[model samples]
Target: MSGRIDLGLLVAALTAALALSPAAAAPQAGVMDARAQIAAAPSATITNGLITATVLLPEGDKAFYRGTRFDRSGVVSALAYKDRQFYGPWFDRISGEVRDFAYDGDDIVAGPNTAMVGPADEFDFDTPPGWAEAAPGGVFVKIGVGVLRRPDDAKYSPFRTYDLVEPGRRTVKIGKDAVTFTHTLAEPTTGYGYVYAKTLRLPKGQPRLLIAHSLRNTGTKPIVTTVYNHNFLTFGGAALGEGLSITTPFQITSGRPPSAEAAAIRGRSIAYLKTLRDKDRVSSSIEGFGTTAADNSATVHDDGLRAGVTFHGDHPLSKMQLWSIRSVVAVEPFITLVVPPGQEAHWTYAYDYAAA
Candidate 1:
């Protein structure tokens, strides 16, 4: 027998040795470990190899829009990405109190002296015929969507509650790359008979999410209202104060500018003046938007975390507002819908995240 093995035999032996080596087994072992860890994690949470998130179901009794009696039933909680949170603490504010308004039979007598709600069309249709002129005092009833109006404009209607029926939720995975959460709500009564649906998706291996919405008027009356997402952001569990800023692509004309001690606008961005103390707040409405949704987009950045988030929509933004207090920063983007009976309208929004 030859002292050395033949070349073909030697090659075969080397190949067999490599196949059994630790390096060759490491990849599969690592994968199995990750899978085991994920399987052990809590249910109500999602992870896509890159980011992890928790799903927040409606609290049933918590009111989304302060003062409104309607319960919140939808995807209404904080979104965590890149080790940072992107929502305000739930139940952080007091319930919005109903304002006094006098009613004389079917007509309002007095009380809501100023326009405290808006988007113009909702103020016209959602509110009673003569809310502003109603007698100086009367009973209070929650009736329309709550929105802040310009202080100088008494032409709009006062804040009222919109009865948001509890939303039905369905969650599913799309292939191996994404997960989708759908929330559907329909007006239970003949009043407002508007059917609303929203689908939120998180794609695997990406730093972005998508939200699609549809509204249909199922009643005999036309449904004219404005819908907006109040993105209340709390970065790294920090309050809204110094080191936080917001930027837009166009010039901003606020309905209410920030106070001198809170923040200021620099070029196309709003920079915090200082770390806000408790009760300190900054709020404003951003004007200067075109008819297209592409023109409406904004970014909220936190210098302390070196992280930021961008929000954009697929439909025209009828209005935009910014509000922040010591605890939360909210960027509200409004869309106007004029769906006739049996008609429907659709829109979508995208959120992108980045970190340095």
Candidate 2:
């Protein structure tokens, strides 16, 4: 009689045990599963031969950016240029338990309250209409996300995901080189509504991507807010450390500054110093810009990859900020939108990519 145990059975048991371990638990640390989640997500790809961008479409049952934070439509999940990838997942995985985000070793993990990628935009985040007046169960209007039910009497916060009351109507038009999303939302309870259309286009022969937006007030209420794009930029998953530089036309000043050891602010640039490990962070509320559209421009470079992107907008800069963790760096630029009933406002942004 042979005394050797079954080799295949032993291997399978060992694998199963590892899978059941706490450190290997998924939807948390075992976040490689995000690959499957992204694959199953519905999206569209647009390219101009120089740059290729894939946007996650909005769906009631399986939307890509399900969080209540950013505008869901035109969510760019992936972008590649010159064989270098940008705007990929900065987190290991997305979870419902995470209030906002938590540092996990080399990766940042996000919760349903704030899980998104690429240049995601948001409108009037600090003051969603009807939030204060709405009862605990009543609903308030969030322009891009839809109607959300008020959870409690607590002050409004972007760190928590409110229950969805309605998503209104979403229409999508996709082309080979461009894609557009139009959201028509009318919340009678808050007396606020609008027709918001956002278009992402890749110029035919240029290494540039453009985002044009038009917001038309369709309801009786006036829509006064500030809309900003969270330019979540990265280069091939490079750490947000040395060799990274962000430049703006105007000199840079900040009300809230980042760690001097992590980042340094020169005359017109935010310079990264040493590498970010563990729970290190860099963030600031950038100020000092005049009322000119030309001032609303920034150029970012990663010297290691010899690649970079420049972001500019047609509207004047109302506010700006810089933020980063270990895996991603974001330059947030804001513009004011004031549309009265039956009126509309328009703005545009351009991103030019370069690699040498």
What C-alpha lDDT values do all the predictions have?
A: 0.49, 0.78
Reference-based TM-score, model 1: 0.63
Candidate 2's residue-wise lDDT over 1-356, tens digit each? 11211222332213110010111111222233455566677676677778888877776545556667788788887888888888877777776767888866655678865677899998776887677778888898888888888988888888777777777777777666777888888987688898899999899899899999999988888888888998888676877778888899998898887788888889988998988767778888888888999999999898987899999999999999988887888899999877899999999999999888
Write model 1 residue lDDT over 298-352, tens digit each, in one string: 9999887788889888878888888766655777787777879789888777788
Clashing pairs in 2: none
Name the weakest run of 10 consecutive residues (lDDT summed) in model 2. 16-25
Quality of model 2 by C-alpha lDDT: 0.78
Each model's total of backbone clashes: 10, 0
- Clashing residue pairs, candidate 1? 67-96, 101-138, 102-138, 109-134, 109-135, 110-134, 110-135, 143-161, 144-160, 144-161
The regions of model 1 sitting more than 4 angstroms off are 1-43, 59-73, 88-191
Residue 76 in model 2: lDDT: 87
